[model samples]
Target: MSTAPLLSVDWTDHVTGRRGHLVVDRLVRGVASGGLRMREGCTAEEVAGLARGMTMKEALHYDPRNRYVPLGGAKGGIDCDPRSAEAYGVLVRYLRAMRPFVERFWTTGEDLGLTQDLVDRAAAEAGLVSSIQAVYPLLDDEEEARRRLADAFAVEVDGIGLDELVGGCGVAEAALTALDRAGVPYAGTRVSVQGLGTMGGATARFLDRAGLRVVAVADVKGSIVNPDGLDVEALLAARDAHGTVDRSVLRPGDREEGPDAWLSADAEVLVPAAVSYAIDTEAQERIRARWIVEAANMPVLAEAEERLTARGVVVLPDVVVNSGTNAWWWWTLFGDVEAEADQAFAQVRGAMRALVGRILDRSEAAGVTPRAAAHALVEERLPEIAERYGWY
Candidate 1:
């Protein structure tokens, strides 16, 4: 339980003068798993925090019976807006500079401000075999595993890739599991989602399909809200690469408000599915929702989570709530599940539901937050994993 990361590196892009950081929090069987993200103002501290969260996320899903034993945690971040003309070059150079780690130690994929396809392209342009090449050595059948993961990535549901939907699927299921445990009805429940991109859009869609109303969804531009329910599908379809919804997609009854207005929407559930550290202590006060499910990593600050817990608002930690996407990648790559959509969805839902149930039960039993319960679960499981595999 040391707080120190196993390794940390900072790189300066010579062309754009932007900086990128990498932090490997831990390693299992000689490799660590995480994602690379690009955004304005991304820092080493933020990347370190995300790497630690990846550790917890991996440990939370540890199962001895499964073929996919959780790998260790790592993360990479670049301080540049992904929309900038030079961002792609920055990403390629960053990958090139980190090729040694990518080859031997760290397995990564797309995160905030990037997509898997983009990462693959950049990695290829950087003269790399694959973004996740480091994990190939552990696979039982490397060729089959690579093919399976590629097929899984090619699978799409409702116009969104399965990889993009799994995390949100897990988030929606986590929310539903919490409601079921609390004896709350899903029907007519209102959900306000922040971000209409991959996570938020998929989460809203799943919740809507499950009979909940997504009353409002905010993008980078502004909030599009309709008390009755905004059309989640339409908005999702209209979103740009950055998750911003096009204003022309607004319906007759939808009202546009400031970007931060989703915080004030009257809803039972609020999903922060966008950037890290989005909701601060002061911002948490504006939220009227009973539950804040973090579909994005580190969306709720620690102090804000403490205050929200004091106010009886349950904040589902990112470590548990947003882990399905990562888990699905390994599940496919490690042969626990096939490349098929139904199999992947079934595996993700079953695992995420069970994990969330455990977290909530431990929360009530120990009189602690779900995040605390999740951390405790990780603490218990990591030792077990290390006992079997030895910490690398």
Candidate 2:
């Protein structure tokens, strides 16, 4: 459990003095998979931890009957705000510097501050064939796999791309599974979410449709709280490319509060789908929700989770919750599922529910938190995967 990875590279952009890092946690079949993120405070240690989480995410989905064997974990991050004017140039330069790795081992897409289109654009600018082309060598039919994934990405549901919805679909399913186990009916269950971007927005939509009341949602502007659920679709439609909602779309009854107010909302479930370490010890004190579903990576700090656990609040780990996006890509490309949305959704739901159940079961049996239970599950799988493919 040392945070050591197989390889780590740090790059400094010449033009703006910005830094970037990539960490390959482990390798399976000569490749690793994760995503690239751009944010101002990114660092090598953060990327390394994320890479380790990717390893866990990949290992958790392993199955002998499935064609999509998980690859090694890896991640890339750049220190620049995505909204900054020079962000694109920094991204291209970082990709250019890491081109060798992208063409060989690390297959990445969007994460946190970056989008798929932006990553694809930057990858192309860096002279790479594709952001994921490094894994094409492992495919049965490379061309067919490429076309299928492209088609899958092209398919959109209710104006949002299919790729954006799967992760949220998985997150919502995890929450529902937790609620079901506790015998809590979804009809009156209230939920609050932080972030209105791809993961959070999609989660709100699905949870609302699943009979949960989405009472509050926080974006960069502020938290929009309405006692009776806000209009999920309208807010989603009103968001800019950066996932910030236009203030003009707010309803007369919606109360706008500070960014962190969502933490204290009167809801059974709270989702931190935006930034890492958002719920520190101070913020954790404000959360009254019975369940904190992590749709974002490392949103709950260790100390805060310890305090929350003592208070009997369940903190679902991101490795299992937000893993649907990564699993979907491999499932589609590996031909286990087609590019269609319905089949993709069914697969994600089945996989997430099973994983959540197992984690919670293990939590009770082992007398550990759900995050610890998930870590134990990954620990169980890593060896099996290693035995089959040998360590990199």
Candidate 3:
């Protein structure tokens, strides 16, 4: 069977007379949600691809066994530079004009080159809410991070930390799923997380508190390894704006290495929590862990995943593994947190469990890789949607 065709898009703002693109790559039977990124050189195809990812992500979360097709994931992008204030105003106007799409069909969330402030402004102009802020906690520049810790913790039994602070709900769920599949107890499992950005930092804090060994962590500036276990509390205390670990403050003999070294470290699990397509074909050959969890969106490429599966590595795909943030966004849109913590966590947890089960079952039955199993699952479910709609 042929692959699904890309959604047709109209790339222009009817109100501003500016060029923008609407890529509706997939359709949920009812509603579709995804991020809308604005950047220079953003193309219709890029938005479509991202939308396609969201469709698969939503599907994996909603129906892990591929029993139901993925709900529609749609992403929109405006091709413009972000350096000028004029561009921001134009973007706001563009978003306002796209309110119809936002309200009924697609939901807008933050992505690369977009900030919470920008998201809030655009959302306000369009009379919509920011998905990233809704799902993930928003620490306004004016809000004290330490002061909000209590409020964040009050929401759940577990006290809020850097995990909830940076908000890697997706990566956290992914790590939990990986541990389940490996039969490795979450407590005391050795983990090495690369890229100490929002996702990595959040996942590290959660895993560390949950009893996992965060032996090594890295960021754009540098990498650090502490096989004996690093003091997360001190690290969090000294963390810089970009969540960089201050090397000067380390308590002696804390080995520092280049970023690439983390991938080769010995551990039960490895999470590439940075950005899309970090684990490509070349990097796949260096991976030495039993389980790989993708915390970032599209962190592992298809070709690389295939290679790793050939080597007996069990990989959890980004679609399901990194969907906590997306689920949280949906929850906030449809439910309230104060009244629905159980419901929210259940939806996220259930999705993680179902996706893991489906992958394991399919892999064992066919003697195939988990990545392949997930691919097969998504493929089988895609066509059924068109059938239900009786596409012409």
For candidate 2, lDDT tens digit of each residue in 247-289?
A: 8888988899999889999999999999888999999999899
- lDDT of each candidate versus the true structure: 0.92, 0.94, 0.64
lDDT of 2 at 240: 89
Cα error of candidate 3 at position 240, Å: 5.5
Each prediction's total of clashing residue pairs, residues at least 3 apart in sequence or on different chains, is 0, 0, 4
lDDT for predicted candidate 1 compared with the true structure: 0.92
Please list all clashing residue pairs in model 1, or write none if there are none. none
Model 3 residue 142 CA deviation (Å) reads 30
lDDT of 1 by residue, 1-392 (tens): 66999999999988879999999999999999999999999999999999999999999999889899789999999999999999999999999999999999899999999988899999999999999999999988899999999898899886789888888899999999889988999998999999877788889999999999999898888888899998888888888888887888787899999989899899999999989999999999999999999999999999999999999999999999999999999989999999888888889889989999999999999999999999999899898889999989
Instruction: Kindly report which residue stretches of model 2 are placed more than 4 angstroms away from their true locations once superposed.
Output: none
